[model samples]
Every structure is written in structure tokens, then in C-alpha cells.
Target: MQICVIGCGYVGLVTAVCFAEMGNSVTCIDSNVERISMLQEGRSPIFEPGIEVLLSSNIRGGRLCFSATLDDGALRGAEVVFIAVGTPSAEDGSADISQILSVANELAHKLTQPAIVVCKSTAPVGTACRVQNILDQHCASLQRIGLHRVVSNPEFLKEGAALNDFMRPDRIVIGTDDNQAQQVMHQLYEPFVRNHDRILFMSRRAAEMTKYAANAFLATKISFINEMAAFCDEFAVDVEQVRKGIGADQRIGHHFIYAGCGYGGSCFPKDIRAILHMAGEHNRRMPILEAVEARNQEQKTWPFRALQDQLGEDLSGLTVTIWGLSFKPGTDDIRDAPSRTLIESLLIAGAQIKAFDPIAADNIKRCYPHAVKTGQLQLVDEPYDALQGADALVLVTEWKQFRQPNFSLMRSLMRNPLLLDGRNQYEPALVEREGFVYVGVGRPSTQPVAAALRAVV
Candidate 1:
């Protein structure tokens, strides 16, 4: 199959490279010249695990290529065109699908042959229909006889495990009323789902809704556990034990059950907002989702609030070490990351921050240039280097390296041995046994009453 993938961001680039690996000729198109050039040189613009290797291998095999525009020869004679652009949350909370619409309009003029345009981006329901309408109007204007087929084929790739997710998808969703479009999509994805017939053919609107519903439900699980964690705190109960207790029921298998700082990335937050906006447009209210969003907003501040409960409300001149900066481990994406909330709050209170992440330190530094220039924020190379002379340490993202550390060494390096476990990665008793005062979200504070009261007030 000759495939053209538009908007070579995370989804588009991964989709193109994986298809090429499966013996399909793929041309990935993006407007960003620098990104396209990097891809053409066998470098991935984004830091996804093993993507650069796949991109290089596919390009060397003459199965994959990159281009800056759809006007180029990329879309010519393409069997399927993927609109994998970003559908970021707008200021009004709806998905800003201008990118998808723009691509549809561009394809209307550029496509030399009728092709299936797959909506690979996660958009609100009926977005594919809108794309179809745009293409139809363009076809009528051009005096073309046939209307282009549009399919809602939302991607379900995870950030860190994107390559694996694409190569072995749990299910392949093809949303189209057109039999030809459905058949082509199934055939294109047949290789990935060869072991089992996991292709689910459905209506376009249902497919779009499935994407949002899936993310929203996962987000709700995170929020639900966090809420339970908070409730357990009043009685000094370990949420970990309760999590295990509930997870053993088989009906509630553990997936997104970790009571972390919050859920953040390109998907959960944005998709939840988009779905809420869609509900509002139809005069419907989703109160459960509303509370879920509210809890997550409050949860992201757990680390900073915990820091204040250990140190004073005014964090002036305090040195804090942060273990992770990305939204989650396995990628460098920091969009709406809980680490940002803690960093901003600490900085605002006049605290000096020393942050370290194996891959995301540079991206975090780029986000705070003025702070970096003023020496207020330090992005360190070594994780222990971040702890040097620090008053407190907060584990934000649970990177693999931060799992087990020399707590004795950490205690000796810090000015004050205050540990705030944002992701509940450390056992409070074990951390306290290392001669450090430990604070964790929804966990009992180990500080002395007077000290704890002073820090909390």
C-alpha cells in the first residue's frame, strides 16, 4: 500500500514508520521544515523509544520518506492518507481541530486519486464527518465526479510504548460506512492483528466516542484511587494496601490504579476537556467526569502542598531536588505535568530547584530559560547531583532509576532529609528508617508534631 501520513508528530511519524516496516511504502508529511528534515536524515524529532532506529531502518530500506508539504509528490497516487495532526484542547475547552480541517482542505486540492483519509488523531465525535463534508464541497467545486471516503481511525498508541502498541495493537478500529474504505483499512492493519481478528468495524461517530470514553475512564480510575488515597490519609491507612486489596478482585484489574500526583500528557487531560466541551454543547452535564477533572487538578498540587507541610509556607532560599520532570516515564513529554505545578509553586515561593530526569531535563530547561539563566532552577546531569545541599527531595515522575537509591547517601547530601514521595514510589517506613522524615500523598506524615504543625501552618 502507498500511504501518506500528514502532520508527522508523534502519531503520524510512528504510524508511517511502523507501516513502512510492514512493507507499505509510506511518505510522512509535516509543515515543520526542521522536523521533516530531521526525519529525512533518519532522526526522530520527538524522543520516543526505538523510533529513530525504526525510522532509519525503514528509510534505508526505501520504504519510508519525509516531505514538508502535501503539495509535493507524496500524496500522488496514495492509497490511504492519514490525518494524524494534533487536536489540542482550545481555550474554550473544545478540541482545536483546525489542523485536521486544514489538512482535509489541502488534500482536496492535492490528492491526484480518490483515497481513504483516516482520522488518526483523537478528535470529538463527528469530526470525520466534518472532514468528509469539507472534501465533498471541494470535489464539487473542482467538478470532480466522486466524493473521497473518510474513515475515523483514532490511534491508541501509548507514549513510551508506542512502537510496541502500534506493532501489536490490542484492537484495530475502522470506523466507516463505506465498505471499500473499511476493507482497505482492515487490509492495511491486517499484519498487526494477524494472530487474532481484532479489527472492530463500526460507525465513524462511535469510533471517535470510543477514544474519548476510553481515556476518560482511565482518568477516572486514577482520580478514584487518588480520592481513596486521600480518604485513607485521615485514618492513617496505606492506600497501597487498599489498592492491592481491590485489585485482587479480578473485576478491577490493575492498570491505571496508581495514585500518582495526577494524570497528564497529550491525551488524558486534553481528551477529557474535549469530551466535557462536547457535552456542554449538547446541554448535557457529566458530573462524574466533572469531579474526576476537579480531583486531578487538586492532586497535581499534592507534592507542593506536601513540601509546604514539611518546610514553611514561605519556601524562600530552600533548595529542593526533583527526581522527574516529564509527565510520565518512558517519554520526554511534559504537557500539563504535575512536576510543572510543583516547580512553578516552589519557584514562586522563592525556592531554588535542582531537577534531574534522564531524558527530559533539556526540555524542562527550555521551558524555564529565565529561571535557568538566573541560577534559580538547575537541570542536573546526575540524580544525586540534584540532591546536593537540597533541603527536600520530591519524586515527581517514577523513572526506573529512582526506584531504589542509596537513602543513606541521600540523607547525608541533603541539608534536611525531607522526602516527599509524589507517586508513592517509596515505602514510608523504609524511607523513615533511613533517618529521613518522609511525606507522601495520602500517607501519614512521619515528622514530629511540633515540626509538622509548623510546616503545615
Candidate 2:
């Protein structure tokens, strides 16, 4: 299939690369010249694991290409066009899909022949219909009505594992009332779902709603577990045990049940907000989702609150080490990350900070230029470098490298060996036995080494 994917961001770029790897000729378009140049040189502007290699291989294999703009008839001879632009949240929590609309209008004028336009970006209901109307109106002006077809094919790719997710999707959703459009979209995706007939045909609106519902539910699970963790804290119970007890049930098999700082990336927060805005527009209230959103906002501050509990309300004269800066472990995306909330709070409280992330340190440095310039916040090159003279170490994003370390070395490096495990990745008793004070999300804080050993016995 001849594919044209616009907006070479995370989703679009991954889709183009994966499709090209599957032997389809793909042309990815982006407005930024620098980004297009980088892609043309076989370099990925984004940081997704295993994507750069696939992208380079596909480019060398003559199956993938990049363009800076839609000029020179970029959509010509394209069997399928994917609109994968960003739909950021407006002030009122509604999705600002002006970019999608603008691309639709551009296609209406620039597309030489009528083709299937897939809305790969998640949007509100009727967005695909709106694009269809635009294309149809343009065709009517040219005396070729009903020549184009639009499909709502929302992508379900995660950030770090995007290549795998795209190559082996759990289900392929094609939203179009037109049988021809559905067939073409399915045929385009047939290679990925060859082992099973995983194509789910539905209305365009239903497809859009499915993506929102899926992410919202995952976010709800995270918030629900965090709430349970908080409740267990009040009762001196370990949320880990409670999580295990509930997760053992076949129905609630643990996916997002681990209590953590919060979930922050491109999808969960934005999708939840869009759902709430949609409910409000229809005069409906979603109290459960509202609480989920509220709980997550408060959860992002868990590290700071825990620090306050240990170091008191005023964090002045403190040196804190942060192990992770990205939103999650596998990617360099820091949008709305919990680390931001903690760093901001610590900055205001006059605490000196040292943070280290294997991939996201540069991005975090850009976000806090003044602090770096003034030496209040130091983005260290290594994990242990950040621990020198540190008062407390907070493990935020649970990267693989931070899993096992020389505890004795860490104990010697820091002035005070306070360990706050944000993701509950550590056994408190074991960490306590390492001669450090251990604090976990919902696990009991372990006492000194001798006391912890006695308690374990």
C-alpha cells in the first residue's frame, strides 16, 4: 500500500516506520524542516526504543521517505492518508482540534484523487464526519461529489513499546459506514493481524469513543489503586498486600494497579479531560472520572508530601537526589511528569536538587534553565553523582538501571540515607537492612538495620 502519514510525531512516525518495515511504501510529512531533515538522514527526532534502527533500515530499503511539507502533491498516488497531528487540550478541557481541521481543509484542496483519510489521532466524536464533510464539499465544488471516504482509525500505541504495539496490535479498529472504506482499511492492516481476525468494524463515532474509554479506564485503575494506597496508609496496612489480594482475582488481573506518584504522558490526562468536557457539553456530570482526575493531581504531589513528613515543612538547606525525570521508565517524554511537580515544590521550598535520568536529563534541564544556571538544580550525568551529599533519594520512575545498586556505596555517598520509593519498587525491610531509612508508597517504613532484621525474623 502507498501510505502518507502527516505529523511525524510519536504516533505518526511510528506508524510510518512500522508500515514501511512491513513492506509498504510510506511517506511521512512534517511541517518542521529540521525534523524532516533529521528523519531523511535516518535519525529519529523522538526517543522511542528500537525505532531509530527500524526507521534507518526502512529508509535504506527504499520503503520509507520523509517530506517537510505537503507541497509537490505529497498526497498524490497515496492509497491511504493518515492524519496523526496533535490535539492538545484547550483551557476549558476541550480538545483543540484546529490542527486536524486545518489538515482536512488542506487535503480538500491538495489531494489530486479521492483517497481514504484515516483519523489516526484521537479526537472527539463527529471529527471524522466533519473531515468527510469538508472533503465532500470540496468534491462537490469540483463536480465530483462522494468521491472521498474518511475513517476514524484511532491509534493505540504506547510510548516506549510503540513499535511492538504497532506491529502486533491487539485489535485493528476501522470506523466507517462505507463498506469500501472499511475493506480498504482492513486490507491495509491485514498484515499486522494475520494470525487472528482482529479487525473490529464500527461507526466512526464509536471508534473515537473506544479510544477515550480505554485510556480513561486505565487512568481510573491507577487512581483507584493510589486511593487504596492512601487508605492503607491511614490504617497502617500495606497497599502492596491489598493490591495482591485484589489482583489475584481473575477479573482484576493487575495491569495499572501498582500505586505510584501518578500517570503522566500524552494520553491519560488529556483524554480524561476531553471526556469530562464532552460530558459537560451534553449537560452530564461524570463524578467518578472527576474524582479520578482529582486523585491523580494529588498523587503527583505524593513525593513532596512524603519529603515534608521526613524533612519538615520548610525544606531549606536540603539536598535531594531524584533517580528519574521522565514520566515513565521506557521513554524520554516528560510531559506532565510527577518529577515536575516534586521539583517545583522543592524549588519553592528552597531545597537544592540533583536529578539524573538516562535519557530525559537534557529535556529537564531545558525546563529548569534558571535553576541549573544558579546551581540550585543539578542535572547529573550519572545516578550516583546525584547522590553526593544528598539528604534524601527519591526513586520516581523505576528505570531498569536503578533496580540493583551498590547500597553500601549509596549509603556512603549521601549525608543522610533517606530512600523514598515512589513506585514501591523496593522491599522496605531489605532496603532498611542496607543501612538506609526506607519509605515506600503504601508499604511500611522500615526501622533501623537491627530492628528491621529482628522484625523480619
Candidate 3:
């Protein structure tokens, strides 16, 4: 199949490369000349695990190409045109469909032959119908070309693990009333679903809602667990044991059940806001989701508040250490990361920070250049380096390396020997026996009187 993928961002690039790897001729189109040029040279503009190697191999094999002009290459005779452009959040929390609309107009003018335009980007419920209307209007104005079909085929790819997710999705969702569009989409994705046929065909609106619902539910789980962790802290109960007790049920699996600082990154924050906005448009109120959003925001500050209660209002001249920068492990994305909130709050209180992440230090440095310039913020090469001479340590991300570290070494390096586990990644009693004041989310601390006093006041 000849395929054209518009907007060569993370989703578009990965989808194009993966399709090309499956022997489909793919041309990734982007308006940015520099980005297209970089792709054309067999270089990836973003950092993904196996993207560069796969892209170079497919491009060299003549199955993948990059272009700035959509009309010249695969778009001319493509069987499937994927609209993978970004739909960032608008001021009202709904998606800004301007990019998708603009691309629909462009593709309408250039699409001389009949094709199926798949909405691979996460969009609102009726966005496919809107794209269809836009394309229909454009075709009518042209007076020469026939109308194309729009299919809602939202992507579920996660950053840092996108290649694997695309290659082997848990399920493939295609929502279309047109039989021809559905068949073409199935053929395009047939290779990936061969092992276990997980293609779910449904109405276009339902498919769109599925993506948003999945994200909202996952965010709800995170926020729910976080709330439970807070309650466990108040009542001197172990949140982990409580989680195990509930997660043992077949209905509630253990995934995303661990209490953490909060949920962040690209999906949960934006999708939850979009769904809430959509509910408001329909004159509906989702109080539970509203609480989920509120809890997540407050949860990000738990670590900082814990440290403040331990040390008092005067955090000036304190050297704090941070373990992770990205929202979670295995990715370099720092969008809405909890560490950013904690670091900013600590910095405002006149405290110094030494932070380290296996992958996200450079990305964090890009966002905080002034912190890097001054000695107030230090990005260390190794996790232990972050603990050197620090007064307290906070684990923002539960990376594998951070899951099991040398606690004795940590105790030896820290000046004040305070450990605040934001993710609750360690056993509190075991950590305390290593000669440090260990604090975990929902863990019973030896000295909760200070925290309780702070909460009361």
C-alpha cells in the first residue's frame, strides 16, 4: 500500500517508519523544511529507542521517504493518508482542531484520487465528521475530484515505548460507517494484528471516545491510589498492603495501582481536560473526574510539603536532592513532570537542588537554563552523585535504578540523612535501619507528629 502520513511529529514519524518496515511504501510529510531534511538524511529529529535504526534501514531499502511537498510523493496515489497532526489543548480545554482542519483542507486539494484519511491523532468525538465536512466542502469547490472517506483510527502509542506498542498493539480500533474505508484500514493494519486478531470495528464516535475514556480511566486510577495513599498516611496504614488487598481481585489488576507523586506526561493531563471540556459542552458535570484532576495536582506537592514539615518554614540554605525528572521511567519526556513542580517550589523557598535522571537531565536542563547556570541546580551524571552533600533526597520517579540503590552509601553521602520517597519505592523500616530518616507515601513514619502538626495548623 502507498501511504502518506502528515505531520511528522512523534506519532507520524513512528507510524510511517513502522508501515515502511512492514513493506508498505510510506512518505512522511511535514511543513517544517529542516525536520523533513533531517528525516531525508536518515536522521531522526526525536529520541526514540529503536526509531533511528528502523528509519535508516527502511529508507535505505527504498520503502520509506520524507517530503515537504505532499502533492509530489505518496499523497498523489496513496491508498491511505493518515492525519497524525497534533491537536493541542485550546484555552477552554477542548482540543484545538485547527491543525487537523488545515491538513484536511490541504489533503483535499491534493487528493486527486479517492483515498481513506485515517485520524491517527487523538481527537474529539465528532472530529472525523468535521474533517469529512471540511474535505467535502473543499472537493465541491474544486469541482473535479470526488469526495474521500474519513476513518477514526485513534493511536494508543506511548512515548519511549511507541515502537513496540505500534508493532504489537493490544488492539486495533477502526471506526467508520463506510465499508470501503474500514476494509482499507483493516488491510493496512492486518500485519500487526495477525498473532491475535484484536481489531475492534465500531462507530466513528465510539472509537474516538475510547481513546479519551482509556486515558481518563487510567488517570482516575492514579489519582484514586494517590488519595488512598494520603489516607493511609493519616491513619498509620501501609498503602502497599492495601493496594495488594484490592488488586488481588480479578477485576482490579495491579497496573497503575502504585501510589506516586502524581500522573503527568503528554496523555493524562491533556485528555482529562479535553473530556471535561467536552462534558461541559453537553451541559454535563463529571464530579468524580473533577476530583481526580484536583487530587493529581495536589498529589504532586506531597513530597515538598513532607520535607517542609520536617525542616520547618525556613528551607533557605538547604541542599535537596532529586532522583528523577521525567514523569515516569523509560522516557525522556518532562512535560508536566512532578519533579518540575517540586523543584520550582523548593527553589522559590531559597533551597538548592541536585537532580539526576538516567535519560531526562538534558531535557530538564533545556527547560531550566538559569538553574543550570547557577549553583542552585546541579544535574548529576549518576544517581549517587545527586546525593553527595545533600541535606535531603526526594524520589520523584521510580526508575529501575532507583528501585534498589545503596542505602548505606546514601546515608554516608547525605549531610542531614533525610529520605523522602515520593513514589514509595522502598521499604521504610529497612531504609530507616540503614541510619537515615526515611519517609514514604502512606508509610508510617517514626515521627509523624511534625507532619500532623503542620496539617492541623
Candidate 4:
């Protein structure tokens, strides 16, 4: 298939390269000439694993290419056009689909032959239909009505494992009433799901809602576990144990149930807001989702609150070390990350921050330039280096490097042996044996009974 992807962002780049890896001729188009140039050289603009190799291999095999514009003959002989542009949230919480609409309008004008336009970007309900209407109108203007078909094929790729997710999708949802479009999409995705026929055919609106509902449900699970963790903390119970107790039930299987600072990425936050906006537009109330959003916001402040509860409300002159910056490991995405919230709170409290992440430090530096310039925040090269002279160590992202460490060195290096485990990545008893005060989400620390009581009181 000759495919043209009208975006070189994470989704579009991954989709194009993966399809080309499967032997489809793919041309990924983007307005950013620099980004397109970078892709042309097999350098990924995003931090997804296993993508650059695929890009290089497929490009060498003449199955993949890139373009800066559709009018530059990128749409020539293209059978499928994917509008995989971004739909970041608006100020009112609705998905800003201006990018998708602009791409659709361009394709409608440029597509000289009949093609299947796939709405690969996540958008509000009726967005796919709206794109279809644009194409229909364009065809009507030319008296070549019904020349093109539109299909809603939302992506379900995870950030870290996007290549694997695309290569072996759990399920493929195709939304279209046109039999030709459905068949073409099935043929394109048939290779990925050869082990099973996991293609779900649904209405366009249902497909859009499915994408939003899926993210909202995952966010709800995270917020639910965080709320449970808060409750457990009040009773001196471990949320990990409670998580296991409830997760053992087959009906309530564990996934996204781990108590953490909170979830922050491109999808969950934007989708949650988008769905809530959708509900509001229809004069409906989603109180549960509203609570989920609220809980998540509070959850992001858990580490900061924990610090204040243990140390002092005013963190003046405190040297705090943060052991991660990315929202979650395996990628360098920090959109709405808990670390940001913690850093902001710490900065306002006059705490000197030392943070380290293998890949995310540079991104974090960009976020806190003043702090970096003034030496209030230091993005260190080594994890333990960040702990040098630290008053307390807070684990933010659960990177593999921070999983097992030389605790003896860490304890000796830190000004105070206080470990705030944000991801619940450490066992309290084990860390206590290492001669450090260990605190975790919904887990009691190893503070002296009197000190703990005094702090609680």
C-alpha cells in the first residue's frame, strides 16, 4: 500500500515506520522541515525505542520516505492518508483538533485520486464524520462525489513500547460505514494481528468514544488506587498490601493499580479532560471522572506533602535530591509529571533541588532554567551524584537504574538518611536495615516511634 502520514509526531512517525517495516510504501509528511530532515537521516525526533532502526532499515529498503508538505507530490498515488497530527487539550478541556482539521482540509484539496482517509489522531466525537463531510463537500464541488472514504482508526500505542504495540496490537478498532474503507484498513492491519483476528468494527462515534473511555478508565484506576493509598496511610496500612489483597480477585485484576505520585503523559491527562469536556457539551455530568481528575491532581502533590509532613512546612535551605524526572521510565516525556509539581512546591519552599534522569535531565533543565541558572536546581549526571550532601532523597520516576543501588554509599553521601519513595519502589523494612528512614506511599517509615508520633501529632 502507498500510504501518506500527515504528521511526524510520535504516533505518525511510529505508524509510518512500522508500516514501512511491514513492506508498505510510506511517506510521512510534516510541516516542520527540520523534523522531516531529522527523520530522513534515521534520527527519531521522539524518544521511543526501536524506532530509528526501523526508520533506517525501511528507508534503505525504499519502503519509507518523508516530506515537508503534501503539495510537494507526497500524496501522489497514495492509497491511504493518515491524519496523525496532535490534538492537545484546549483551555476549556476539549481536544484542540485544529491540526487534524487543517490536515484533513489539505488532503481533501490535494488528493487527486480516491483514498481512504484515516483519523489516526485522537479527537472528540463526530470529528471523523466531520472530516468525512469535508471530503464529501470537496468531491461534490468537483462533481466527483463519493470519491474518497474516511475511517476512524485511533491508535492504542503506549509511549515506551510503541514499537511493540504497533507490531503486535492487542486489538485494532476500525470505524467506518464504507465497506471498501473497512476492507482496506483490515488488509493494512492484517499482518499485525495474524495470531488472532482482533479487529473491532464500530461506528465512528463509538470508536472516538472508545479511545476517550479507554484512557479515562485507566486514569480512573490510577486515581482510585491513589485514593486507596491515602486512606491506607491514615490507618498506618501499606497500600501495596491492600493493592495485592484486592488485586488477587480475578475480576479486579491488577493494572494501573499501583499507588504512585500520579500519572502524567500526553494521553491520560488530555483524554481525561477531553472526555469531561465532551460530557459537559451534552449537558451530562460525570461526577466519578471529575473526582478521578481531582484525585490525580492531589496525588501529584503526595511527595511534596510527605516532605512537609516529615520535615518542616517551610523547606528553607533544605537540600532535597530527586532520583528521576520523567513521568515514568523508558521515555523522556514529562508532560504534567509529578516531578514538576514536586519541584515547583520545593522551589517555592526555598529547597535546593538535585534531580537526575538518564534522558530527561535536559528536558527538565529546559523547564526550570532559572533554578538551574541560580544553582537552586542541579541536573546531575549520576543518580548518587544527585544525592551528594542531600538532606533527603525522593524517588520520582522508577527508572531501572534507581531500582537497586549502593545504599551504604547513598546513606553516607546524604546529609540526612531520609528516603521518600514516591513510586513505592523500596521495601520499608529492608531500607530501615540499611540505616535510613524510609517512607513510601501508604507505607509507614522507619522513624523512631516517638518521632513518628510527634510528627503525626
Candidate 5:
């Protein structure tokens, strides 16, 4: 199959590379000339693991290429064109699908032959229909009506394991009323789902809704556990124990059950907002989802509030170390990350921050240039180096490298042996046994009884 993937962002890049790896000819197109140039040089603009290797291999095999525009001979003889552009959340919480629309309009003019246009981006419901309408109208004006087909094929790739997710998708949802489009999509995705027929045929709207609902449900689970963690904290109970207790039931699996600072990334936060906006447009009230969003927003502030509670409302002259900056590990994406919320709060309180992440350090440095220039924030090269002379440490993202550390060295490096486990990555008793005061989500620290009583009194 000759495929053209519009947008060299994470999804588009991964999709193009993986398809090319499967022996399909793929040309990835992006408007960003620099990004396309990087891809053409066998370098991935995103921080996904193993993508550049696959991209280089495919390019070497003459199966994959990159271009800056669709008119640059990339769209010639393309059987399937994927609209994988970013649909970021707008100010009103709706998905800003201007990118998708723009691509559709461009394809109307550029595509000289009939092709299946796949909506690979997570857009609002009816987005495929809108794109179809746009293409249909423009094609009619050009006296080539019904020359193209549009399919909703939203991506379900995880950030860290996108390659694996694309190579072995659990299920492939193809949304189109056109039989030809459905068959073509199935043939394209047939290699990924060989064990069984996992290709689900559905209407375009349902497919789009499925993407939002899937992300929204996962976000709801995260917010639900965070809410439970808060309740457990009120009773001095460990949310970990509660999580395990509930997870034992077969009905309730252990996925997304771990209580953390919050859920953040390109998908969950933005998709939830888009769905809520969709509901609002139809005069529908999703109170539960509203609460879920509210809880998540509050959850992101947990580490900041905990720091203030430990070191007083005014954090002036305090030196705090942060363990992670990316929203989660395996990717350098900090969109709506809890570390940003914590950093913002800490900087406002006049606290100096030393942050360390194996891959996200440079990105964080870019985000806080003023603080970095003023010496209020330091993006360190080493994890322990960030702890040097720090008053307390906050574990924001649970990176694999941060799972265990030389606690004795950490104790000696810090000005105060205080720890806030934002991801509940550490055991309270074990950390306290290492001679440090440890506070975790819904976990009580081993504070002195006298100090607790005095505080209560």
C-alpha cells in the first residue's frame, strides 16, 4: 500500500514508521519543515523509544520517506492518507480541529486520485463527517464528486510504548459507511491483528466517541483512585492497601488504580475536556465527569499543598528537590504535568527548586527559563545531584530510575530528610526506617506522636 501520513508528530511518525516496517511504502508529511527535515535525516522529532531505529531501517529499505508538504510528490499514488495532525484543546475545552479541517481542504485540492482519508487523530465526534463534508464540497467544486472516502480510525497508542501498541494493537476500530473504505482499512491493519479478527466496523461518530470514552473512562479511574486516596488519608489509611484490596476482585483490574499526583499527558486531559465540551453543546450535564475533572485538577496540586503543610505556608529560602518532570515516564511530555503545578507553586512561594529527570530535564529547562536564569530553578544532570542541600524532595513522576535510590546518600545530601512521594512510589515504613520523614498519598508519615499532638492541639 502506498500511504501518506499527514503530520509528523508522535502519532503520525509512529504510524508511518510502523507501516513502513510492515513493508508498506509510507511518506510522512508535515508542515513543519524542520521536523520533516529531522525525520528525513532518520531522527525522530519526538522522544518515543525505538522510533528512530525503525525509521532509519525503513528509510534504508526505501519503504519510508518524509516530506514538508502534500504537494511535494508525497501524495502521488497514495491509496490511504492519514490525517494524524494534533487536535489540541481549545480555550473553551472543545478540541481545536482546525488542523484536521485544513488538511482535508488541502487534500481536496492536492489529491488527484480517489483515496481513503483516515482520521487518525483523536477528534471530537462527527469530525470525520465534517472532514468528509469539506472534501466532498471541494471535490464537487472541482467536478470530482464522491472521488474520496473518509474513515475514522482513531489511534490508541500509548506514549512510551507506541511502537509496541501500533505493532500489536488490541483492536482496530474502522469507522465508515463505505464498504471500500472499510475493506481498505482492514487490509492495512490486518498485519497488526493476526491472532483474530480484531477489526471492528462501526459508524464514524461511534468510532470518534469510542476514543473519547475510552480515554475519559481511564481518566475517571485515575480520578476515582485519587479521590479514594484523599478519603484514606483522612482516616490514616493507606490507599495502596485499599487499591490492592479492590483490585483483587476480578471485576476491578489493577490498571490505572494506583493513586498518583494526577493524570496528565496529551490525551487524558485534552480528551476529557473535549468530551465535556461535547456534552455541554448538546445541553447535557455530566456531573460525574465534571467531578472527575475537578478531582484531577485538585490531585495535581497535592504535592505542592503537602510541601506547604510540611514547611509552612511561606516557602521562602527553602530548597526543594523534584524527582521527575514529565507527566509519566518513558516519554518527555510535560503537558499539564503535576511537576509543572508543583514548580509553579514552589516558585511563587519563593522556594528554590532542583529538579532531575533522565530525559525531561532539557524540556523543563525550556519551560522555566526565567527561574533557571535567576537561580530559582536548577535542572540537574544527576538525580542525587538535585538533592544536594535540598530541604525536601518531591517525587512527581515515577521514572524507573527513581524506583530505588541510595537513601543514606540522599539523607547526607539533603539539608532536611523530608520526602513527599507524589506517586506513592515508596513504602512509608521502609523510607522512614532509612531515617527520613516520608509522606505519601493516603499514607501517614512516621511523625513523632508529640509533634502530631502538638499540631492538633
Candidate 6:
């Protein structure tokens, strides 16, 4: 199958490259000339694990191509056209469908033959119908071509592991009414669903709602665990133990239950807001999702407040080291990262930050240029470099490097021997044994209690 994926953002590029890898000729279209040029030279515009390898191989084999104009490439002979443009959040928290609409209008003008237009972007319900209407109007204006089918096929690819998710999806949802469109989409995705026929066929509206619902449910789980962590803090109970107790049950089944500094990324924050806005449009109040959004905002400040309680109000000359910058590991995306919130709050209280990440440092510097200029936000090359001359350490993202470091070196480099474990990455007793003040989310330092318990035993 020949495919054209519009909008070479994260989703579009990954979808196009992965499809090309699966023996399909793919042409990825983007308006950005520089980005398309980079892809033409066999370089990925974004950083995703195993993507460059796949992209380079496909380009070498003449399977994948890039272009600024869609009309000249796969759009002419494409069997499946994927609209993978971005639908960012609007002022009212609704998804701004302007980009998707623009692509739909463009596709309507260029596509002369019959093509299955698939919505691979996260959009509101009834968007496919709107696209169909746009295409219908375009065809009526031209008075030369017949109608085509528009289908909703939302993607569920995570940032870091997008290639794997695309190649081996857990399930593929195809929402279309036309039998011909359904058959074409099913055949296109057959290679991926060979292990099991996990292709779910449903109404267009249901498929759109499913994408939002999945993200909303996952966001709810994260916010629920974060609120529970707060309760555990008030009662002096360990949330880790609480998580273990509940996660042991097959019903609960731990996945997003780990308590940390809320949830932040490209998807969760935007999708939750978009759903809330959609509910409001229907004059319905989503009280649960509203609370979930509020809780996540507050959770981002947990580490800042913890540090204030330990270090007092005046942190005028304190040098604090932040271990992670990206929202999660394996990618350099800092869209709504918790580390950004923490850094902003700490800087307002007059504390300098020495932050390090494997990939996100350069991007973080772009956001906080003043911090770079004023010598306040120092982007260190290595994790230990951030610890040098630091007063305390705060672990934000659970990167592999920060999981187990030389505690002895950490103790020696810091002005105060304090460790704030944001993701509960270290054992309380282990850090305490190294003669450092260890603070976890819901667990108190075990040094004092461990000695007494050991004597009793």
C-alpha cells in the first residue's frame, strides 16, 4: 500500500516510517521546509529510540520519502492517507482542530482518486463527520470527482517507545461505516495484528471518544495515587507499602500506580483538558476529571514544598541539583514536565539549579534562557557535575543513571547531606546508612527506627 502521512510531528513521522518498514511506500508531508529537508537527508527531526535506524534503512531501500508538498508524492497514488497533525489545547481547554481541518481541506483538494482518509490524531468526537463534510464540499466545488470514505483510527503511541508501539500495537481501532474502507484499513493493519486479530471496529464517534477515555482513565489513575500519597504523608504511613498491598490484587494490577510528582507530558495534560472542554460544550460537568486536573497541578509542587519545609523560607544562596529534566526517561520532551514547575518555584525562592538529563538539557535551556544567562540554571554534562557544590539533591525523572549512584560521592559533594527522592527510586535505609538525610514521598527515613528495630530483633 502507498501511504501519505501529513504533519511530520512525532506521531506522523513514526507512523510513516514504521509503515514503510512494513513494506509500504510512505511519503511524509510537513510544511516545515527545514524539517522535511532533514528527513530527506535520512535524518530524523525528533529523537525516538530505534526510529533513526528504521528511517535510515527504509530510506536506503527507497521505501520512505519526505516532501514539503503532498501533491507530488504518495498523495497522488496513496491508498491510505493518515491525518496525523497536532490538535493542541485551546484557551477553553478544547482541542484546537484548526490543523486537522487544514489538512482535511488540503487532502480534499489534492486527492483525485478514491482514498481512505484516516484520522490518526487525537481529536474530539464527530470530527470524522466534519472531515467528511469538508471533503464533500470540496468535491461538490470541483464537480469532477466522486466521494471518499473518512475513518477514525486514533494512535496510542508513547513518546520513547513509539516505534515498538507502531510495529506491534496491543490493539488497533478502526472506525468506519463503509465496508470498502473497513476492508482496506483491515488489510493495511493485518501485518501488525498477526498474533491476534485485535483490530476493534466501531462507530466513528466511539473511536474518537475511546482515545480521550483511555488517556483520561490513565490520568485518573495517576492523580488517584498522588492524592493517596498526600494522605499517607499526613498520617505518616508509607505509600509504597500501600501501593504494594493494593497492587498485589489482580483486579487493581499496578501500572500507573507509582506515586510521584503528578503526570506531565504531551498527551495527558492536553487530552484531559480537551475532554473536560468537550463535556462542558454538552452542558455536562465532569467533576471527577476536573478534580484530577487540579490534583495534578498541585502535585507538581510537592517537591518544592518538601524542600521549603526542610531548608526554611530563605534559600537565598542555596545550590540545589535536579536529577531529571524530561517528563519521563528515553525522550527529550518537556512539554508540561514536572521539573519545569519545580525549577520555576525554586528559582522564585532564590535558589540556583544544577540540572542534568541524558537528552533534555538542550531543550530545557531553550525554555529557561534567563536561568542560563544569570548562572542560575546550569546544565551540567553529567549527573555528578550537577551534584558538585550543591546544597541538596532532588530526583525528578526516574532515569536509569540516577537509579543507583555512588551515595558516598553524593554525600561528599553536597553542602548538606540531604536527598529528596521524588520517584521513591532509593531505599530509605540504604541512603540513611550512607549518613545522608533521605526523604521519600510517603516513607520517613528509616535510620532512627531501623536501629531500634534491629536491637529488638
Q: Give the number of the best model, judged by TM-score.
A: 5
lDDT per residue (tens digit) for residues 303-323 in model 6: 898788788878778999999
Better of 4 and 5 by TM-score: 5
Model 5 residue runs over 4 Å out of place are 447-457
> Can you tell me which runs of candidate 6 are displaced by over 4 Å?
144-146, 446-457
CA shift of 285, model 1, Å: 0.8
Q: lDDT tens digits, residues 247-279, model 4?
A: 999888988899999999888998999988989
Who is ahead in lDDT, 3 or 4? 4
Q: Compared to the true structure, candidate 1 yields what TM-score?
A: 0.97
Off by over 4 Å in 1: 446-457
For each candidate, give its TM-score against the true structure: 0.97, 0.97, 0.94, 0.97, 0.97, 0.96
For TM-score, candidate 3 versus 4, the one ahead is 4
lDDT of 5 by residue, 56-157 (tens): 999999999998977779889999999999999999999999999999989988999899999999998889999999999989898889999999999999
Query: Given candidate 1, what's the lDDT at residue 124?
Result: 89
Error of 2 at 134 (Å): 1.5
RMSD of 3: 2.6
Worst 10 residues of 1 by lDDT: 446-455
Which pairs of residues collide in candidate 1? none
lDDT of 1 by residue, 362-437 (tens): 8899999999999999999999989999999999999989999999999989999989898889988899899988
Q: Cα deviation of 388 in candidate 5 (Å)?
A: 0.4
Residue 35, model 3: lDDT of 92
| Candidate with the greatest lDDT versus the true structure | 2
- Model 2: per-residue lDDT, tens digit, 1-457? 8999999999999999988988999999998899999999999998999999999999999999999888866787998999999998999999989999999999999897879999999999999999999999999999999888999999998898999999899888889999999888888889998988888999999999999999999999999999999887765678999999999998999788999999998889889999999999999999999999999999999999999988889899899999999999889999889999999999999999999999999999999999999999999999998999999999999899999988999999999999999999888778889999888887766333345457568
TM-score between model 6 and native: 0.96
